[model samples]
Target: MQLQPWIIMATISAFLIQICLTVESPPSADKIDLGVHPLELEHFVNMAHSNQVERSCGKYVIPRVTSRVGFSYSANTSFYAFVNDDMTARDNLKFLQRWFLKFPEYKNRDLFLTGESYAGHYVPQLAQLIVQSKVKFNLKGVAIGNPLLEFNTDFNSRAEYMWSHGLISDITYEAFTVICNYSQVRREIVMGSLSPACSGVISQVSRELGKHIDSYDVTLDVCLPSVVSQSERLNQPRGTEKIDVCVEDETIKYLNRKDVQKALHAHLKGVSRWSICSEVLKYEYRNLEIPTIHVVGAVLKSGIRVLVYSGDQDSVVPLTGTRTLVNGLAKDLGLNTTVPYRNWFQGRQVGGWTQVYGDKLSFATIRGASHEAPFSQPERSLVLFNTFLQGKPLPEATVVL
Candidate 1:
């Protein structure tokens, strides 16, 4: 089987941007509605095509950021409404097999699997299937950003992260740790019942955190109009420098446009609007508990490199828990530390800290970034992406005299 010479980037819970094949200059900032936040996507692509990237990796590969047909705007919930991680993984495997058969010209070219957030599960599960299947893909590596690897560790860490960041009161933090951790709360919610104690704790925490903050990025401000109308119309600045907090709303509007939908061959099946998340598809919430960290271990054992990265500022799937999980996974796999934990540089500033285990498994954090690190810190994320694809360690901190 011949796979496309493509770097597949998936966003788990965001509006899909149909495949962008060219490397043209990015559009102006004023034009924010390109379905998937053009600034971030274009910025990453432009960086990938830079002369520096060419010098580092010998050549630049045009990346193709796509989502599954049954997801986002392409979903036909009228027929098949229920979906889960396993189903998503199987669907992705089938998609890739068909893609390989259709694009035989991309034979022997390198392919890297990358995603963020819940893709923590989707990417690994699909990779595991690919590795175990009969198909032969030149699978280079897998990278997940602010991924959910383990349920308890990832969700339970939110309390500490919020407390440390001063997003919640001390009393609420204590309640979160003792009376009800996030994992327990999540379980109850999934089961469609929340205990009185957990419900009270949640209310108190919500009151303390207020309505202005974004839990995904504790440091970033929420879009006011988005909160009110559920649309992206505000011109306010966010806590993060240069990131548009209203991009999600813009994407929702763009994807729902009749022209945009027609152009992409997408239609709203048994639905009136296109949402960032599926409104009709009932996802199996229990699947969130099935940890994918072990699947990551299996991928590593299959000779496929794994890169687990986090955005340090993210309370949801914060760097602390991810680091612990990666360290534990390394110890369990008996992989020795090949690269000691150290700061990496993006130009003159520190990009983040990274550590490699036995050359196959690695962990890193994007400093001053959010759960969606690439959306918030595109340049640094690009640097990390390039380094990972080239099978090179992140650049060491540069010295200045």
Candidate 2:
């Protein structure tokens, strides 16, 4: 995918800040009329702004900011609902809270937050905000698919698992290990080596998987099930030889996507760039308090739901990391295990598992998918939403972790 030059340039100038003047204003506690629809679809439906890519779904109109002029958010390539990285999650939350307050339909609807891979970070951040909103607004539940909520534990395990499973090449694995081992070297490598590593993985995996395929864009999670199923059935000489190649392809794809790179740039822009970890570390305002999980869990206890899921084959943020994050929340809630967990999707073998801590907090996994379940398995994704929207426990097919 071709990213706009301005975005590319903005990425290079990662530390440049856009200034905003803050004025103290009383928080509006006004409630809006609950319309049939929960969102202001019309505001986005006929967006006069030319740079945005808009798509209509039911009463919803999703817009993508394709180019950055002044201040911008959303991934720049394809149109998906991407939160802005330039601002703190708190800021993003405040924006959404005010939005719901302004639009009455959203007040009583089942509000949700979702994302994949790096969005893993976004998913929890938004969830934290929603919990805060519940004190004042009507909120439902939050669902995170293959999210990257925990960095050290979840992220490291994902990389190692992908390596052991042969999804990433030995060389790439070594490169990752080196980059992750030293802070300075890792930053230099991430900034410079991301594209090469990503492109190489895509090429190698596509070729090894199918000769019939022409283009290999591993970034699209939409391509997985068919590719994985077919490759599993290929009775050729090396039947399982490339079975997991897509994993490596996905890893590289995640690292190289211009939008994510843009996020990293946004995170680093205008900060001290002395360390490689600076890209992520520079986003000081985005940091969460250690008690965040507990605070979020407490809010959920008040009748809201929290569902965190991971794709079985995801190497970026594996099932274990999600499990760890949930465990933390569970501990905070102080329930030995009072909530019920069950199957949430059909057709796929018990998509991982789920566990509920009372009615407020829940967790589940999507089977036969990667980081992005909506992109990889829309039908199942819809099933998840259907259950959550109705405020029902995930089905029996979803295992209890």
Candidate 3:
């Protein structure tokens, strides 16, 4: 007896479903198609417990578009939104391996890892790890935006930025001097009372200094002022749209889960510290030799790009920092050749610049934007990524915006 087409299709579908069920899913709740242009993006979330989705890079799968590739890592494990830890890095590599196995067509794809802020550290560390695994893996380039690569430079840049941005005042600067001179205990106590007026004075002094400063623990001081203002701003409801891009509610839940934190805590033992800059600077600074890659765009690549983006209005790692980091990476990779600087934004002097390193390295910057330009201006970011994907130099500013 011959079966009907519908019946045959149903039987085949059921059999396939059973086979898939037996094969073990990709350790993800479900894969979602973001429907972005140029690339048909697929996303995955770790919903092991709660119904809410927790974005996990290692869990997401997308067909390799070209030999060129892009990777994103969560910024910091301390915060669920930015799960930047050794475990996450291992998982990312594992996922890439799985992705390669699942799609052999991308065997020759050149990989470019990118991220921002906390990713400054995450991107480079992962790149180093992936390169080490190059005997078994293939990678090409990396980009980091406002990365925190060098402990000294990173902290100093933050201090200089805060001062220049008018976020710190002379009083705050004095407090900073005192803190750096005294014990951490005394510094913390003094910093607790510095007001906005003090912060503004610090900013003016920082500008006058005209160079980056790093001799103090200014992360809290720099960010406290902004955080306070942001909290106030967030107090007002923004209609129905979400204003901030973070997994705050889900993050809290994950943090509260002892098992989850334990899993993360184990991996974060030595690599991550509450204030890595301060701790390392005091003791373990010399132990760091991890192969690192920093991915930066012309603008910010916050959670949207798999990292946290910290911007300083007054910064060396400002637009300059991103440009310098990418350029340095390009040069280090032998990709830095005499490529022309192109203006990509309208009325912007230098929206972007390009240099081709050896054969597989490249670098460029975004136009008219500050540290977090990627978040502020995404279109340009897309343009930069697209160019990098094509293995071509970034275009010079044409329309002059």
Overall lDDT per candidate, in order of appearance: 0.68, 0.43, 0.37
Off by over 4 Å in 2: 1-86, 97-102, 130-135, 168-295, 301-303, 338-349, 397-401
lDDT of 2 at 175: 55
lDDT of 3 by residue, 1-401 (tens): 00000000111222121000000001111111111112121111242321111011111123211111111112332332222246445655565566568656545544446544444544555555665675454444455555555434343444444555565666655665454412232233344654454454455555655443322212212222256754654465644422223222333334335574464332223233121021211211122222244432311221112222223232544544444555665555444455554444323344454545444444455543334444333455555655554555555545533
lDDT of 3: 0.37
User: Residue-wise lDDT of candidate 1 within 335-380, one digit each (tens)?
Assistant: 9999999999998899999999998999999988887776677678
- Off-target runs (Cα >4 Å) in candidate 1 are 1-79, 226-241
Give the candidates in order of TM-score, highest first.
1, 2, 3
lDDT of 2 by residue, 140-216 (tens): 55555655554456645644555676656776666555544222232334455545544554455444434433121
Q: List the residue pairs that clash in candidate 1.
A: none
Q: What shift in Å separates residue 174 of candidate 1 from its native position after superposition?
A: 1.2
Instruction: Give the Å shift of residue 126 in candidate 3.
Output: 3.2
lDDT score, candidate 3, position 188: 35
TM-scores for the candidates: 0.81, 0.51, 0.46
